[model samples]
Target: MDMSSISRHEFRLEFLVTSLLFTAFCGYGLVWIEELVISEHWPLDEQRFWPGKSYDLNGYLDIIVAGKEHPQYGRPNILSLRYLDEVARINQYIVHNITVPVDLEGKHYEVAYTDLCMSFDWACYLNDHLTMLMPKSRWGNFSGPIAEFASDIINNEVNITYPIGWRGSEPIYFGALVGRPHLVDREGHFDHATALRLTYNVGNISYIWRKKLASWLTNKEKPPSGESQMLSETAAGEGQAHCCLV
Candidate 1:
């Protein structure tokens, strides 16, 4: 081959190789970024932790009432009458401020309290859910923190002061359950029983059942009152029973 042709061929080969390497590096970097985000925001364990039911307002109310009645499961002061009152006010505010689109059937349904709380600017849903699921022993003096959090939420404050141990930035849906020592021991060892309790009792089974009940209630054209009693009983049972585990 001519000298110029040989030189051109060499340059083309080098260019192709460099482009492939750049593309591969970019692909790897993207994958790593996605993994990091998922681990911090939605851990694999939490993604697997589906409650298998939709959350409705009544079911959440049932859970709140049950928590108030049985304070041993969570922070005693946070589950008091005052807390219930605040929650009711917040619910009203949400109903008025937020406009949820109606279904095709033209039946207007209020947003589920749980759904609203979860979507709220603050981490109210995570705080309440963890407070109820985690034993009171694990929670140390959350009364003051939770009270302030609730008040801020009620006042529609933009800058929220999150409770200790709860993530304010990059909120994780159920990342707390996995990060806490409840699933792992002091030496960073995994506890099988604790894991089972979290998976079956708190996350998988009980949570799923409550969600299902909530879904059923919201889906109904005219939900009956009898199910509320059953839901309340189930919530009470879950609070009392699940708290005793691990």
Candidate 2:
């Protein structure tokens, strides 16, 4: 080969080698960090490490509720949950303000309340579903810091009670069951790009494990038919649910 051609070839080869080295180094670092977190930091046994029913969970989502700040009909605060593969079960909680009225009956009356906007990320699963825990509280009132609400969400304590309007009915207290989907209205609002980036940035190591587990789960089974039906129903219940598409 001519001298100039040889030099160009050498430069290309060097560049290729440098790129490969950088990539490998990054990959190795990711793996090492993951190992450290799982083993030394938040270590658990193999069985406890990945709990919950196995599913592919290609990020199907359900709504929990919408809280409005003004307690008005048109405005809504959004709260939602989604299965982001097997590694992360995400909670997106939005708050709103509301007011409900009940007429005084001779014998019975109803108590109504409205939602008040907050941000939260409740933790439902740990180490890609190894262990699950509930947050201490669900939706926080608008008076607190958003980060506190987010911390509560990650801890899995997101049970919110919103008053749409006052109706004369018996009072019932309740809590959410773990592994159960939220009772969402028909519409949903989310920033997919933002959530995805947040997931990776917050749990980049878990993402690596999630991809592998998700592949295995997908091969093992399919999403439940009942769940599919429920999701479809939500889509159909848009107007009744008072939701806006996002």
TM-score of 2: 0.24
Off by over 4 Å in 2: 1-5, 45-63, 67-72, 75-246
Off by over 4 Å in 1: 10-14, 30-207, 210-214, 223-246
lDDT of 2 by residue, 1-246 (tens): 699988878789789999999999999999988777656643433223222121212221223222222335442222223323211232221111112233455554332111111112322331211122112242333445887666755444422222121112321122221222233543221111111111111121223223332232223243221121111223311111211122
RMSD of every candidate to native, in Å, equals 18.7, 19.8
Q: Best by lDDT, which number?
A: 1
> Tens digits of per-residue lDDT for model 1 on 190-224?
22111111211223223444454444334334332
For candidate 2, the C-alpha RMSD (Å) to the true structure equals: 19.8
Models 1 onward score TM values of: 0.25, 0.24
